[model samples]
Target: METILEVLKKMEKATAREMAARMKIDAPDALAMLRDHEDRGEVNQVNGYWQLTGRASKKPANAVPKKTKPPASKINEAVLVKLLHEHGAMTSEQLAKLADTTVRTVASTLAMPVNKGRIVREKRGNVFHFNVVSKTALGASKLPESASKPAIPVTETPKTASIPEKTETPAPQSSTAFVDTIPQLVSTNGQPAALTPKIIAGEIRKTKSRLVQLEKLRVTVRTQTRLQRSLGL
Candidate 1:
């Protein structure tokens, strides 16, 4: 409280923000302090500014007044966007009047959204027209001209061929035209003209035994001749 009072005593007039800045306090705290002082008759409001009471005023208590800054106005961007979007477009001069803010503040606020692609602007001489970009038209604008036409899709039905009736196959041909062997696979006469493998094997064993007997006989004749010559017979 003393910090605010001392600041107020120095300046002819001060806003909440200015008082807060000098006193190292929040604006709301400064405002509350000022209101408390005003209630206690320590300070008074002069055109929305905080000033010391006439008794503490450095100027003559009846010295009328001098020009001072008006209360600071805040820019309402949401209202700005709505107003521009609904009203088609408007200049900063016109927007400031509608938003009850400074033209400079409105101009700067509108420019920020434009650089972000959220708004659009058009210029004419010294003034520029601003409007918030609407999302409803975005999709339609991005589509190609050819896409706008309704597509007529053609669906082709698959061709189904007629199924052939089932038919009986002829009996297999025994023509024997492709036969390679006759003696081994077919009968030449009604009699069994084939030789059994067992009979052939038996004949081969007999021939081998007869050859072994002849070899023994030859060995015995050589032994007898050698013995008779030794006995001189």
Candidate 2:
């Protein structure tokens, strides 16, 4: 009997019936041999025609390749710590911009408990700033006191020579009196005063001296509001 591969080599490809005829065997026996060859990865079938594995047509290459997403920007822990040390302290937004990454990533890193000992966070105004933990300053409470002591001596002579403080003392009493008169001014005029610069200028020309008093009144109101907030009243 002719071997299946020799028959395939001669015929390029052949059905089981054709193989049986060429090899002088039953079609069922030829088919069983072909299946065994297929299982061994030596032959394959297509449309009831059997062919050697090497003679099978290869799959076509893709014309358009699959797209891949760009890699995300990552900030190493050491690099982040180095940036904070070099730049003093920076907000998460600032660090994110410097590291070419998202603010969420920087925030997540700062939030990690593992970095607690290596980083320190402080609230400056309305935002939090992250800084490298300073081992030397950690125990140095005297550093602040020593720094503040020099400021007292530096500001003492300057405060005594400033004439503005002398003038500002009576300002509180005058500003307090003006605050009471504001309601009366509105009642008499039948409208609230417009505090626009143009209106202030017109009134300044008419009153000349009252603008200074008005400025003092604004400062007093702000101080009062801040005091009330601190006292939680």
Candidate 3:
């Protein structure tokens, strides 16, 4: 916390991103520390930048006191959710960098979201790459592979008034194997719920399109850390 306050004193305003970079910690960690200070009347986020308050204030600067780092226990779901939204997919090891926590911590924390369907974990090679749950998948999930024609949604204008208006569900595929793109889902009754139409036809589809640049970020951070060590920061 003292380290954070000192950094804040040097800068006019600092966003979570800037603070994280300067502190050589994860962005979520910096944000969490700032918020903790804010709750204690020591700091506040102003114009998207964290600013010091009270004893931690800029005027009549206080000495940067030595303090032990706090144990990381709290899991910031909002930060995790935001990261998944931006990157589309990431492993817990990669995600730990953004959260400024250990990979083990993230692995434990991700269980709830994965179980709840808020995050989908797909096994790529060995480690699971966590992706955001597609909120718009509802429309596409109802159709099976055997469906001959894509049903025109009720929202669209019909070509002719004489034509009968009806919504047709696709026949369920016999294969139970999960697809590479979207995994097949089953309901509580152990019945396969088709997903083809639910994923594609839905007006509100939210799937991860791009992979998170975790490796690049890790490389850059390592370089920065080495530089900081050399400078005795």
Candidate 4:
């Protein structure tokens, strides 16, 4: 019996009927066997023709092509951090140049360590300096004491109240008043108080509308970001 590998090697591309005839087997039986092999990942369909799959291309003497490494931007952030640690603290511009990446990428990498409190910043005029904050310094009190100054006790000031507090009394209710005598302001009068319910309803409606708009915007932003990254923008 001809092996699947042998049949595959003999024909780079072949239909079910063609493969069956070549294998000297019935069409239906050959098709079934081919399908089983395909399901096992030994074969794949390309343009309606069966061919050996990548997984099945491994042979004793055949050298497999080495996979190319992804670009610097695609490198893991953790790996980048380790690389930076080995190289010591460097400016974002310097790191970007070294990594063969954009300054934005280097800034993003630095931001991660800074946010994690692993690094500290010092401002000298306009330029910012970044250094790894030592564990002892991080735990120490941030406030500095004046060596020549003596400690002074805080004094509380005495309170003086010559004026007495005036208690507010509620306005006398009108005997003929109804609905609390508060006029129901309307939109026509340039007062929107009466339209509170309508305004709230409109706000809720607009909120849902805005939410849908935001979701679409988020998807669009993601698509644009992906496209930009893919184009190396």
lDDT of 1 by residue, 1-233 (tens): 24567777787688988977876655654675576556556688767787878744377878887554464366556888988866778887898888886665575455446656677878978887888777876677778988988898999975444345578997665635323223343456633334567854765687699899998997898679766766799
Tens digit of per-residue lDDT, candidate 4, span 115-217: 5577765666776655666667766534466633677889986443334447799787763343234344334454435446686577678779989999999
Better of 1 and 3 by lDDT: 1
The window of 10 residues in a row where model 4 has the poorest summed lDDT is 178-187
Per-model RMSD to reference:
28.8, 29.3, 37.9, 29.3
Compared with the true structure, the alpha-carbon lDDT of candidate 2 equals 0.68
- State how far residue 35 of model 4 sits from its true place (Å): 47
Kindly give the stretch of ten consecutive residues in candidate 2 with the minimal lDDT sum. Answer: 157-166
TM-score of 4: 0.26
Candidate 3 Cα deviation (angstroms), residue 221: 94
lDDT per residue for candidate 2 within 109-169, as digits (tens), equals 5543223356787899999888886777655644667664655444543322312333434
What residue runs in model 1 are displaced by over 4 Å at the alpha carbon?
1-72, 122-127, 138-170, 175-233
Per-residue lDDT of candidate 3, residues 177-220 (tens digit): 44322433565556666567666544133332222366567678
lDDT of 3 at 138: 44
Better of 2 and 3 by lDDT: 2
Error of 2 at 199 (Å): 99
How does candidate 3 fare on TM-score? 0.31
Q: Cα lDDT of all candidates, in order? A: 0.68, 0.68, 0.66, 0.61
